[model samples]
Target: MTISFSDLPIRDEFRGMTPYGAPQAPLPVALNVNENTHPIPDDVATDIVDSVSLAVRDLNRYPDREFSLLREAFAGYLGHGLSAENVWAANGSNEVLQHILQAFAGPDRTVMGFGPTYSMYPLLTQATGAQWFAGERGPDFSLTAASAVAQVEEVNPNVILLCAPNNPTGTPLPLDVIAAVYDATDGIVVVDEAYFEFAPHDAPSALTLLDGRPRLVVSRTMSKAFAFAGARVGYLAADPAFIDALRLVRLPYHLSSLTQVAALAALRHADTMLATVDNIVEQRDRISATLTALGYRPYESWTNFVLFGGVADPQATFLALYERGILIRDVGIPGHMRVSAGTEEETTAFLDALASLEF
Candidate 1:
């Protein structure tokens, strides 16, 4: 007899909730998830393999509990006067977030974020036994300093999650709004910058605000611009005391030795690994321009994806693309869909397929 999940001993909060994921399929041209479609440089991959191979000989011992060397490398890459003391990393940005929530938010505590942002924020909050409070964004999915501060003052959450260049909508969050929100809340403030490398070179990061602010954290990932999504590496920078809080909750030696070495190897070739960012940005712009020309409204994105509106039927359009072996995302936004900036040819296939469809 098959047992029902509802009859099991799962937590009440998880009873009816679905796990978070995009539709995964083996399509010819897939831009559903915002992944860097570019392959790692052959030389870099070889070096990573060599590094991992060396690490393989030490399988008997547990990895460094602090992951000091990797932290130092991340510090060097991020610069901005950040040192190893300010850096903390986990398997992925999601885990980094989970750690933050676990440390500062739990049972009866509230975590808040603006709507139409990264969907994972709410899910992560719930999983950590914290209440999820969704604040609103503008009609165009934009947020300003005054608006953000007002929401934070009202909710008074224990933790605030700000997704810079937000997911699902691609709206860029200005530093002024972040500073205002930080000033408004005594809660721990997290700025998730998973797509920071895709933003303009001159764009100021939340890292610039970290010096005097102990409650502020700036999280980043090597998954996108580094073409290391499969490696599952993400990191953050904050006051050393804040990093200490994460350590209190993290499992001992959470990072594997192999993961540490592979990440170190990738960091050594950071410049070479990031060469595809410009090309991806170009494709993203191309998608936006062509979508606008075709009468769809595309938002200004500072990430490697575009969220376009004017789809009369999002599901129908999604299925139509699926039939053509070109998969994109329908991010539960009415009359809108999101697509990643794939390689040039893949982007062409998506555009050509989209153009052929009627409302």
Candidate 2:
């Protein structure tokens, strides 16, 4: 029998969603998605194809459900105490989050976090039929550790979704605060560091917290610092048992052989990716300096993107830049626009785009 949504009543909130679509651009300098404007090297691409081609014979068969090879490469490159036993691979960080919600979050349960986070945490929870609890951040877009900890201790959510160098804002929570919240909450804490590479060294190490806390899970993605947006290799590091739960729900052969090969290749040359990261940091400083000079009050960003206030209306600024062939996200924080830190050329282009704008 075929099912039709027209005949059934689903959740009312689903209908309230604004359809989450954005306009597509041509030649798409594509700064909107926080992707690295740089592509992988020709040599790395060649290696990926070569390795995947060799693994092609097993394409008809299912892949290693554990993705040990990728995990080994991941742990090796990241240089943390991560082992294959403690890692969970997925289609993307998004999938890892979905698995977390499926395993920990449920209808009567809740996933709590601060506002202006990774945007998808609440969406993921709602999609999984769980309640989303959001605590407002201070005016600086910086979340106070004490407030965040209080919310967790009080709400006692099933999953604590956190983003250090939180998306859209790029400010990190204090380390002691993260530890305090962990000590306070018995539930799983999922610290998403999609922008971890750019964060300061003294920032709380989510990996370190995994030891004492059985439920601490940190989600990472190659799509960010590794410059592999198309690769879609994101993972979580946590207690081996928690990782095993992900395997049960994850589809067999979830990641393509080619994608795994590409991730491995990128990881092999982690230094190259890091060089680009250093460049992004430089670009961030340059752009931030320029914005400050323009009287744009910017939050202290530790990620590859910057957010600013003091403009008349950020929507107008975004539209003006959009007309100039640059696409940035209007974070809806009045006078605040988020621009991804790009290469020097792209950074200058963005500055020019902004200079040409009337807003």
* lDDT (Cα, tens digit) per residue for candidate 1, span 198-297: 9999999999998889999999998989988999999999999999999999999999999999999999999999999999999999999999999999
53 Cα displacement, candidate 2 (Å)? 2.4
Instruction: Please report the candidate that would top lDDT against the real structure.
Output: 1
Worst 10 residues of 2 by lDDT: 15-24
- Residue-level lDDT for 62 in candidate 1: 100
lDDT of 2 at 24: 58
Model 1 steric clash pairs? none
Instruction: Tell me the deviation in Å of residue 249 in model 2.
Output: 2.0
| Model 2: per-residue Cα lDDT over 1-359, one tens digit each | 88755446977757556444445577345577788877777777787788878888878877666677988887776557778788877778998899999888978899998887777888889988899999778888777668887777788888888888788888876667677878788888888888888876566567777776778888899888888877788988888889877766777678877677767877877887766887888888888899898888778988888887778977777777877888888866666788889988889999877876774
Candidate 1 deviant stretches above 4 angstroms = none
Q: Under the 3 Å rule for N, CA and C atoms, how many clashes does model 1 have?
A: 0
Ten contiguous residues minimizing lDDT sum, candidate 1: 1-10
Q: Which stretches of candidate 2 lie over 4 Å from their true place?
A: 1-9, 21-23, 201-204
